[model samples]
Target: MARVPAGADLELDVQLEGVAEGVLVTASVVAPLAGDCARCLEPFTSVMQVRFQELFAPESAEPADADEQDAVESYPLDGSGQLDLEPALRDALVLELPLSPLCEDDCKGLCPECGVRLADAEPGHEHEQRGAMWAALKNYRAAGPEGSSAGEEAVPDGKAGPERTTDRTDTAPGQAGT
Candidate 1:
């Protein structure tokens, strides 16, 4: 077992089959990692297990095959000709980490209207009021004196007369006192 820089552990166990030209590596991996959840902004820990088989091309291949041979890697063999499995097992485990993690099944996020934390909201918490501009307009329509219309005269349908005056007052500004 070997420890990586960020506290990840790598372990490898394998049986290497050496052919006339190349070596095959089979191994298992274990990894422990930490990440922040995307939705809830909480930390989470996870363990990942991976297993893989890698074919290692030999170093003595022809010069014309160098480009294709460079694409593959050859594992170093011990004095007894057994393949070392450490490097490949570590690589596979690191690739298995989640790009984005989620902390819980239901993460109530921040409120869009008020930017408050939705998960921590009170049972009947009312929203903040910025002062209702149209409060007088609404109150005027409700609960006026009974049988009293607010000067909205009903025009008789069959009668002909001058058009109803929409302007509340015709008094000139400076002549009102006289």
Candidate 2:
């Protein structure tokens, strides 16, 4: 959830060196990041510093070896050997962004029941939670007889049940009527 905003200005300190194949660019970037916290979901801003090195080479001369290929990039520099540094800067900065960003290391996040920001809540904040087995009992009052067969007594949960029938002629086989 963390990312750098588009159109944000980046501060760059760069060193250009002439290598055998191309111009090597070594740069350190300071970027402004804006993102939502993964836990508390609060908007926050932070600064990230990244260091990257890349070779801006002509597109015609492709690196032959896999290892060498990674060390050098085939970026088409302009006729004057001018470098386009945005892609290299983006790649380096994105790798350093935290996947699960938090407002703080000790952020408590939102309460499960009330959804209030737990960090802002009073000390020892909690709700009256029942155990799973007992928690299911609360639905009995509203659990109407959705699948109860005819002639069997409906569960007594302070709600109305079907009218009782005296005849057992229509009852399914082996099912006793009450």
Candidate 2 residue lDDT tens string, 22-48: 778899999998888788888889888
Clashing pairs in 1: none
TM-score of every model versus the real structure: 0.48, 0.63
Clashing pairs in 2: none
In candidate 2, how many Å is residue 47 off? Answer: 1.4
Question: In candidate 1, what are the lDDT values of residues 1-178, reduced to their tens digit?
Answer: 2222385565556667677556787777666656665665556665556788877544445344767657755554445555556566656765665666555447565566676656677755445444353565456556454224533343332232343232224345336767
* Candidate that scores best on lDDT: 2
- What 10-residue stretch in candidate 2 is worst by lDDT? 157-166
Q: What local lDDT score does residue 178 receive in model 1, on the 0 to 100 scale?
A: 78
